[model samples]
Target chain A: MKRWLLALVLCLSPVFAQHPADSAFSHIYVSIEGGEQYPFGDLIDAVENSFYGGVGFRYAYLENIDGFILFDYSYFKPVPEGVKIYGAHQFSGKLGLDFKWKAIAPLAIGAGFVCDWVRGDYDEDKLDEISFSNDLGGTLTDNETEFGWFARLNLPLIRKETYKVGFNALWKELWTLPKRSETLSVGVYVERRIW
Target chain B: MKSFGKIVKSLVAFCSLASVGAFAAVDAEMEGMEVDQRDDGTFLVGSPTFFYDRILGAGGLHSESEMWSPEKLRQRMLLDRMSILPSWDVMEPSVWIKSGNELGDMIYRDFITAENRPTNRTPILEGGFRTPSFKGFWVTGRAFQDDHFTTSNFSYRKSFVDDEFAIFGENYPMFSTMYAGFGYSANSIDASFLAGEEYIWIFSESSRWIPIHYKPRLEARIDASNIEATVAYEDAEYQDKRKKEKGARKELNGSVYYRCGEACRRGMLQLSAGLAFRAVDDSGMVYTHLEEDRAFLPFVNLRFEPFNNLAMEAMFAVNERDWLVQDSLEFRPPVPRYTGVVVGVKNISGTRLNPLADGEEYFDGDTISLKADGQMNLVQGYTAFSDTMGNVGMGGRVSFWAEHGAETFDVDRYVEDDQMVYRHGDVERINSWIRGVTGELWISAWYREMFSFKALGGFERVDGNSSRFEVTPVEFFTSFTADWLLRKSFRISQSLRYRSDAQWNLRSVDPLVVKGDWYWDATFEQQFPAHGLYLTGTLLHIIGSETIETPNAAENRLRFICTVKKTF
Candidate 1:
């Protein structure tokens, strides 16, 4: 946990230390986003709808494009289902490119790679009934680290000189744990220029 | 062999001396010039490059192609800008030599049998020259030979002759281009089983373009090719019967492409469509009763960007191919010899004494034919977002693909005894179809000049005609890569990959399931920009199990490769 926190701090420190407004290569900003995620594939039977919140730092180095790195966390309360997964938590890090377009308002389109780490608590009775041995001669675990890709589009609803409000949609595939998982989400965000 | 060695040695010595003199001259010329004004003319002459590789290990029972082999030596020289001639604008010449020992066997397996042929050493040599555009005309020629030294059981050798000439209009209102080429390849293989084939091909293509809107262009292209092959085989019976076969194939394709908007920019649109036709004719004693086959196919593609931040693309195609008999065989018995006793017996019996005069009869040995028709479609959309500084960008894409195909095969079986016996009643026709869908999502992030990350995940569901089940098993794949440029001249990258278990049926056989596995790889690279030198070292399959599922059990092994490249 300490190492992850340190890495996060190191990733964000350069943005605060540099003066991006005067430099042609840097435009620093922070954003907060929230959205509802719908689980599909194997997860549909174990988990229901969930909401996620994320914070990210973005730097624009080109005329209409910016690169960003973000971290998101989601919590899900499992529904009464066949396998009885009590609850699930997921954490992911996303790195991607976004292109900003100015029509009547600003529209930002983005796509990137995602790395996910997921853990769930299951009922002992359910685990005893469903667990099976893997090729490595070990029982299946409730925790897994998976990798996936995602694409998203964002539309700014309100814009000001230093702040903006927007709505965005995202689609992602999480392939792991002997099955494939898909997620689609729509949410709103608020962005503020830091430099 | 000695004379060849002398020629190669002389060429290498001459190139080394020429490069040294050219570099010295360039350095002398740059003595009084500013750094920004200096140009390295040494590259115009030529550069000598050498490469070497060694295989570490390989896994899988059928992984003969992946087995380790030592590449003892590879040398190449690239020369450009030899425009001293009056009519030629520029000339480029290249020569390459490679020698390696292949310590693996070539395995051929069918539903019924498998053969493993061992290879010992292989050597390849090639030389080519290309001419720049002179009066809108360009030409190139190349000759190459590849020799494989195998065990006493099999022998294989190949040689190639190729040439091409093309012309294009540079300043015309409409772009016009045409090219024609011919290739000849000879291969001889002496194996326990006797088979030999020779192939020859010729091809041509022509294209014209018209500008419709500002920078919007439409182009049309037509391409045609003809191929001919001759084959001979001898059976391993008491009296080896030799069979000769001949085949001819032809193809014609045409397409039109249109492009509008800025193709390299954020918003662009391009569309293309094409049609193709093919025909194959076979005639010989081996296929005495077969007929010619023909097919036609069509395809289209579209790419559009309705907004600056969003792009969408789609493609659809129907592919059809002529019915092809994979490997067919026929047998014939020799006519019997005449004897005086047979004549006396025929006279007593009041029958003709012409047992030796009977005509030869043909029997089907093993017959296999295949026909296929398939269609595939794909659609994708992508959008991106970024901050004002453009240093950080995030993007995502969603894509869907589907394909449907039908394949049919005709098979026949026969028996061979003192003479040849044909099994006319043991013929079967098999037909099958496959349908599958795939969906994928991709996300990527880039940090300015330092690090970048990308993730991709997808799912595939396939179904086919099989007795085991109609629904094929689902499979999933995901991978991620992280690259960090620690400095301007050095970089390191790592990747991880995972795939889900998959099951599929083959040739009306039982379903086969392959257990999924994980893989990891890492690479390190360094560059010397001033000298045009780059070096890379890669480690593959560093964290995966040594065993994976194949038609036959295969073992995965770790390997490493290091490469050095230089442009003089």
Candidate 2:
């Protein structure tokens, strides 16, 4: 947990330090977020809960809308015992639009697309020691990726001229094999406005 | 004034985006992967290399690629088909990278269920850059490959090669290509020369995939003033380690054409002429052998519009060994201001669809003839009409075609090797006449430059000895497509389509049926005009069953592709 937090902070420190707003826009926000993802349905038996940290770029899209792009990284452990690999490293990229409906001033609803790329964290020198035919984590040893759709709610807790604090929760369904995999993620972010 | 210019730019981009007819994101990593984008035909992809693509209204049993034209002179001759996929065409001035994979890999699902484990999904990788022109001179290089369908008959293909048979990875994909070259561009003058190595699998007349390796394929092209010319030399090596057979083929092919200039194109009569030729030399046990090791053809294309609403177009190609002629005449009677109608008659008569192709294919101790006796002729009459009122529009077309001596396959028997099935066959023609009727309808609506929606449907019925034809095409298909641009920065394109079942008659003992179903493909793109950067993600085959469309091809599974490109 400590290492994750430190990495998250280090990954986002430079953005907060440089609040350069040269380009003109009604709104622009650079943010750093940390979140926990929970597997749903059959996926719960596949992977355990994991924490993720990511950076985001938000820009004004329309009078009542905003667009955001996100990049996140997480480490997931297999729920099944006796898996061949230690854990899986996953990188997530998302592109979404937030609808800041006047009816819900500070709260916005959004839907977008998500892409996840994953590879098992294992030792390469021991490739000969691995057998993949029926193993749980064996397939992850090779790079695996999936694309899906996500819907999220964005709530701004504290808003200011140059900074803001917000909470975001999203549900994503991955188009995985046999059946689609679903997950819920909740995170809080600190954002600074940049052009 | 600056803000107004920005709005105009946005409108231009939006209009251009919506004009693409929703080619859908059927795999942007490769050209011609848009087989799903074709609805007027029976299209089946055996692999990235092999497919049976026949337009229903095209009025013949042979696939479109099996026929030759001057327009396809630059296309790679893959066995009996002229294909542009796995093409070597250069790109616009841009730096780009694309990556994608077949979607159904187990991922986490592998941990839970041990039974019926899914096959490992394969990936596609592509990256290249064409440098911005440096005073009319530029350089470009590319390395690309698709490992998607290689897993279907992995072991069988792998045993034919000593090593991976690809630039990278152990998967013996259907094709792996890498090339680099330089080009010069100026007003009315463009020239380029490229050399590269490629590994490709060509599907033979006997339903076998023959692997060919081009160690250094060289191509040079120039388009200056009103003339365009191209030439290529290939040094291909063939090997089937399983059978301990090895062969080599050296070939040279090219074309030179002259078209009407800009000023002449404005006149009522326009003309274009070209000559295409191929010369080959083979040694050892080559799978296919060309007749007399040489072919030379000269072709001409003409368009004559003597008056308004009436036009005639014709293209004719002839050589010592073959001759082909295609001509179309159309008339547009006066109609309402907002409505249009065109009635046309088209005819195609050809001694051989592809005269430059090899004459014979050697497979499993059987000599398979690639050419059929006699000639084929097709005639079609079509009438199309369209009207627009306000923001809504509708159009429809109906065509009836008849053909004599349509090309087909005569299968003696079938052979099974590993997971793949092969056939012993000779190309033959149906002497009796075959007929088909096709109808298509479409409706569309648009709102300024922000949104557009189009729905299209088509049906075709074929008659007369249809069972003997190599493929019985789909009967009907429908598609719903839409495009939306939000705030001039984000674009969304989506399509949902369904096609009826199609069948292949002679590839196996039991006819192979390609069950058809609904498929959803979508593409999302983010454009930063100021930064000249574009990021796009596309998903394909969302709702369709993962079924192989051809006899020995792999499943056409759901896949996703993402690209990041920056135009200069």
How far residue B372's Cα lies from its native spot in candidate 1, in Å, is: 6.0
The TM-score values for the models, in the order shown, are: 0.34, 0.89
Best by DockQ: 2
Docking class of 1: incorrect
At residue B317, what lDDT does model 2 achieve? 94
Candidate 1 Cα errors over 4 Å, as ranges: A1-195, B1-271, B279-369, B372-443, B458-474, B491-493, B507-510, B536-568
- Chain B global fold similarity (TM-score) for predicted model 1 against the true chain B: 0.40
Please tell me what DockQ candidate 1 reaches.
Answer: 0.01
- RMSD (Å) of each candidate, 1 decimal: 30.2, 8.4
Stretches of candidate 2 off by over 4 Å are A1-25, A41-45, A102-105, A129-134, A156-161, A186-188, B1-29
Please give the distance, in angstroms, between residue A96's alpha carbon in candidate 2 and its true position after superposition: 1.3
Please provide, for model 1 over B1-568, each residue's C-alpha lDDT reduced to its tens digit, 9 standing for 90 to 100. 4474354335323322321100011110011111111111000000001001111111000111111111100100000011111111111322222111111111100001112212111222223344433443344443322221111111110011111111111111111111122222123211111111111111000000001111111112222222111111111101112322222222221222222224433346565554333233323342212123433434444556665433444434443322111111111123233211100000000011110111111233533221112321211122222222233323322222222222212223333333212232211122343334444554555566555555556665544553332113335666555555533444556555565654433312344464455555555454545555545444444445444222211222333333344533
